[model samples]
Target: MTSKANRPCVQKLRCLLSVAVGILCAQSLAFRNVDSAAFDSFANLTAKGLDSIAQFGPAGSIALAACLGALFYRIYPNFKRVGKRNQLISVILSFFLALSIVVPRLMKLPNVSFNSFPNYVGGVPKWHKPIFWMVASIQLLTIGFTLAVIICWLMRKAADLVECRNTGEVSTAIPPTNLSIWERGVRFFDGKPMHMTVATLAMVLCWLPMLVIQGPAIIGVDSMVQLVQFRTGHVWDPMTMAELPGYVGQDHHPFFDTYLYGLFDELGLWLGQEVLGFRILIVLQSIVAALAIVVSLIWIKKRTNLPDSCICACWCLAAILPAFPMYMSIVLKDSTWVSIFLLWMVAFFEVIYRCNNNHAIGWRLVLCLVVLGLFSGLTKKLGIYVTTVSLLLAIIVIRKQFAAFLISMLVPAALVIGFVPMVVLPALDIAPGGPQETISVPIQQLSKVAILHQDELSKSDRQAIDRVLDIDHLKPYWQADSADYAKHYGYRLNASSSDRKNFILTWIRLFFRYPKDYIAAVPYLINPFVYGETYYYSGPVRCGWWEAGGSRILTEYPECGLSYTQGKIAIPLTNALNKTPPFSFIGSEALYTVWLPMLALGLTISIRRYRNLCYLIPTVVSWCSLFLLPAHQVRYTLSFLFVFALTIALPFAEVLTKERNISN
Candidate 1:
C-alpha cells in the first residue's frame, strides 16, 4: 500500500513538471510571434525615424517583469520564508543583472525604426518585440534563481541560529492560551447566523450604489452610452490632433482613459457590440472592486479576531462612505487605483503582523512592494506618490523588511522616469518640439497679460489680484512649461532651466506658506461631493460661495463659512486638548457644533487610548492634510471622510466591547 501511494505521488510530480515545461515553451512561442509582428510594424510607428524599443531597450520589460514577479511571489508560501537581509541583496543583484542585459541590447539596436508597425497595421497595433521577450524571460529567471538561493541560505542560517541559541536542549512547546479574548471571540462567533447577517448587511449598505450604477452599465444602459460620447468627444477633443473634424480626442496620458475605454472597445470588438461594451467594463470593474473589499474585510476579521460587527462596520464604511461610490461610478483611474491600494494595505498589514518571522516578512514585503509599485506606475502620478509613501512607511515600521521595500520602490521610479517621461510625454507630443510649445505660448502670454493688467487696476482691486497672482510667493509652473512666463513675457522669472523643477519648488513653498487654503479644497476634488452642479462649485449651497450666480455669497452670507473654517476649528480643538493646559473655553465653544463633534471625539479617543492603532493615523492625517492644504474643494475631502468614518467607529466598537464585558 505504501509503495502504491509513493508511485502515485511520483507520477503526479512528473505530470506537474510536464505542465510547467509546456507553459514555458508556449509562452516563448507567443513572445516570438508578438516580437516579430512588432518589428515588422516598427517603420510605421516611429516619428523620429528611430526605434521605440531600440531607444529604451529591454530595460523596461525586465524591470516590469522583475517587479511583477516580486509582487506575485509574496502570495506564494515558499518565498514568504526568506530573511529580509538576504531578500534585499537578492533584489539588488537581480535589478543590476536586468540592467546589464538591457543596456547591451539597447546599444545593439540604437538606430532601429519604431513607426513602421502602425503604418503597416493601419490601426493601433500591439508592439511586442523579441528584445522585450528576452528581457522579461531573463528577469523572471534571475529573480526566481536569486530568490531560491536567498531562501536556501536563510533557511540554513536560521537552523544554525536556532541551534546556537538553544544548544543541546530538547524542549517541548507549551500549549496556547485557551482563555485569550481573541480565541473566545472566534469561538463565540463561529458558525453564528448573526455574524453572517452583520457582514451581509454591511456589504449591502456599502456596495448597493456601486451595484446600481455598475449593473446598468454592464447591461447596456443608455447612461453609459451618453457618458462615453461626452467623454470621447467633449472631454478629450482628439479631432485637432488628427487634423480632422469630430474624430473624438485621446488624452496622451491615457492610462486611465484607455483602461476605462479599452475594456468596452475590446468587448465590443469581440461581441460586435460597441455602445454597451465600455459601460459593461466599468460596471464589471466596480463589482470586482466591491467584491475585493468584502473579501479583504473577511480576511481581516479572520486574522485579527476582531468582532464580526466591527469588521462588518469597517467594510460597510469603506464601501458606502461616499468617496468610493462617487469615484467608482465614473470612468476615472481613482476607483481602480483605490481598490488596488486597499488590497495592498490589507496584504501589507497581513505580511507584517501574521508572518512567521523575519524571513517571511522580507519575502512578503518584496512581493507587496512589487504589486503596489506596478499599480502606482501604471495608474496615475498620485499612485506613484502614494506607493512611495506607503513603502517608506512600511520600511520604517517593519525595519526588518527594508530591503524588500527598497526593491519595490524601484518599480515606480522606473515607471516615472522611463515610461512617463520617455513614452507618455513623447506620445502626447508634449516634448520640447511638440504641442506643449503651443500650450506654453498661451500660458506665458496669459501670465504677462495678468501682470500688465495688475498695474492698471485700482488699489483695492490690485491688492486682491496681487493676493491671487503672488507669483513671487506662488510656485512657478514646473512640468513641461517652465519657460512659460519668460517665453510669453520676454523675461525669465526664475534661473532654473527646467520648467517642471521651478514649478515644483515654487508650489512646495506656496503650499507651506498658506496650508489652510490647500486643505479647504480637499472636498472639491470629487465632483459629486461638491454641493452643486457646476464643475468649480463647492461647499454648502446655502451661500453659493462657489456658484456661478452667487458671487456675493461670501460677503452676504459670511455665517455660511467655508469647509476650511470648520477644519481650522478642529485643529485648535485637537491641539488644545493635547497640550499641558487646554485652550480657553470661549474659542472652543465658537467652533463647537454637532457635526464637528465627531472630529473632537476622534482626536480625543485616538490620543487617549488608541495610539497603537497606527492605521488610523494615515487616514486622519490625510483628512486633515487635505483640509489644511491647498485648495479645500469639496471633492478633495471625499476620501478623507471615508477614512474619517472608520477612525470614529473604532472607538465606538471598543466602547461597545467594554460595555458588554462589564454587563456580563
Candidate 2:
C-alpha cells in the first residue's frame, strides 16, 4: 500500500527534477557567452523577454498564467494515462501552475514607466521580477513534463520487451508513446461529425471578423500588384513586360495563377463595388477552406475509426490555430495553398493507402491528387516539393502500385514544370520567372558580415563581393536577419559563369572565418518555417497594420486594405503571445509545416512504421530548401503543420483497425 501511494509522488518528483535540470541548464547557458554570439543573443533575448514582462504590471502575469494553465490542461492527461497515482501528482502540479498565475499578482513590483524617457529602450527591469518567477515556474513544469514523458515511454517499451521475451511470444502491446500525447498539441476540440459541422459553420461565421479584422482580401504587396495587373489586363499583356520579378517575385510568385484567379475581382466588380465583390470572394474562400477541413476530418473518422471524442479534440485546434480559418479569408496564394495541400493529404491516404488491390484506386482519384499537387505547387513554391514527397511516400507505402504512383507524380510535375512554364506561359504572353532566389542566403550572410565582421573583412573580400554585386551598393544595404537590402547589390539576374565562381569562392572563404554569422543568418531567415518560439499572436492576422498604397489598385482604392487598431481583436492577442511565454508558444513555432514528417519519425522510432517514413523525405527536401526561399512568412509553415497533424492520426487509425480484427 505504501509503495502504491508513493509511486505517484515518485513520478511527480521525477517530473520536478526534469524541470529543474532543464532550467538550470537554460540559466547556465543563458548568461554564458559561448563562442556562438547568435546563441548567446537568443538566450539574452529570451531572458530579457521575461524581464520585460515583469517590468509592466499584471498583464504579463495574466498571460503567463493563462499559458501555463493551458499547458497543464494539455499535458495533465499524459500523467493520467499512466495511472491514478500519476493523476493525483499531476493535479498537484496543476495546483502549482495555478499558483504561478496568482503569485505574480501578489508579488508586487513598481511598473517601469516608459513615459519619462524620450525613447522607450527596452531592458530588464531591476525591481522584483514577478513575471520572471511566473515564467520560470511554468518552464520548470514544461521541462519536467517533457522528461517524465520520455522516461515513462522508455519504461513502458522496456516492460513490453521483457514480457514478450519471457513469454517467448510476439508482443501484442503497441508500446505507448508521447505520440498520443503529442497529438493533443494539434487537437483543439471535441470533434465529431456534428462538431466538425459546427466548426465549419463557425469558420464561415468568422468571415466578418476576418474581413473586419484582416481587412482587404488582398494579402501582400505582391498580391495586390497581381490583382491590379489582372484587372488592367497587364497580366495578359505582352511577354515584353520587362520587370518579371517586379510584378511578382522576379519571375516567381506564379503570375499565371494570379492572372487566372482574377475572376474573383471581376466578379466583385460585377456584383457591385470591387470591395463588396472581393468581400464575397473572401467569404467564399473561407467557406471552401472550412469545407476542406470539415471533409478531411470526417474522412479521417470514417477511414481510421478514430473515436469521435478524439476527433472532436482535434477539431478545436483546426478552428483556432492561426494557420487555418484566419488565413482562409486572407487574399494570398497561401489560402489556396493550405486548402489544396490538406486535400492532397486526405487523397493520398484514402485513395492510395487505404484502398488496396481489391479496390484499386481509380484513375480519377490519382488524377485529382496530381492536379491538387500541381495547383498547390503553383500557389506556393514549397508545395511542389511537398507534393512530390507525398507522391514518393505513396509509392513507398503502396509498393505494388509503384508504376501508377510514378505516373501520378510525373504527369502533374510535367504539366506544371514543362507545359505550364514552357508552352502555356508563352501562349498567354507571360514571362517566365527567374530561377529560385538562390542568392538570398548569400546576401543574408553578407548582410550579417557587413555588420558583425565589417572591419574583419579584407580588400579581397570586398572585391569578391563587387564581382557578384557592386560593393558600394551593398554598403548601405546591410540587414543582419534578411537579405532584402543586400540582394539589391547582387547581379544575380544576369551573372556570368566567372562571376558565379568568384562569388562562390568568396562566400566559402567568408564562411570559414565567420561561421557563427552564417549560422545566425540562416536560422534567422528559416526559423519561421521550422521551429521558432518567438512571441507573436496565435492568429493568422499578425501585424494587422496593413493599408492600401504599395500597388496601383491599392493606391486608387484605399479602402480595399485593412489597418487594425491597437488592442483590437488579433493584434492584442498577438502582442500577448509574442511577448509572453507559453502564449508565445502558439507563435511561428506552432506552424512548423514539416510536422507531418516529424509525426512520421516519432511513430517510426519504436514501431518500425516504415510506411510512415515516406512522408519525411519530401518535407525534408522542402524544409532544406527554405534556406534559399525568399522570405520566412507565417504562411510558409501552413500545410505542413495541418497535414502533419492528419498524418499523426493516421497510424493510430491503422493500428486500431488491426486490433479490431484481432478481437473479432
**What lDDT does the true structure give each of the candidates?**
0.39, 0.52
Q: Mark the 10 consecutive residues where model 1 has the least summed lDDT.
A: 113-122
TM-score winner = 2
lDDT of 2 by residue, 1-664 (tens): 3498798986687566545544432332122111112223446646554553445334644544444444443453354455554334334443443232222222212321111101122233323444444444554555445434543343344335434534548433545463455344223333455655666787577445544565554455456546655655443211112344333222355765575456776775677665565567677777777767766776665554344455666656665655354565567777667777787777776554443422456677778878888887777766776677667765665576665678778877777777877777666666665431556677667656756676778888776665666545566755544565566554445666676677777887788888887876654453443223332322221222133223444333433333543236666655555544433434444334533343334434434334545445445655666667545565666665556446555444332223233210
Model 2, position 233, has a per-residue lDDT of 42
lDDT of 1 by residue, 539-644 (tens): 2212321222223222333323333432343234333332211122111111121112233243233223242244443443343333222222333333333232
Show model 2 residue runs off by greater than 4 Å: 1-199, 206-208, 216-218, 232-251, 321-323, 355-359, 393-400, 436-439, 446-468, 496-517, 529-570, 576-583, 591-600, 655-664
Model 1 misplaced stretches (Cα beyond 4 Å): 1-256, 269-272, 303-305, 315-327, 351-360, 394-398, 423-613, 616-664
What C-alpha lDDT does candidate 2 achieve relative to the native structure? 0.52
- By lDDT, the best candidate is 2
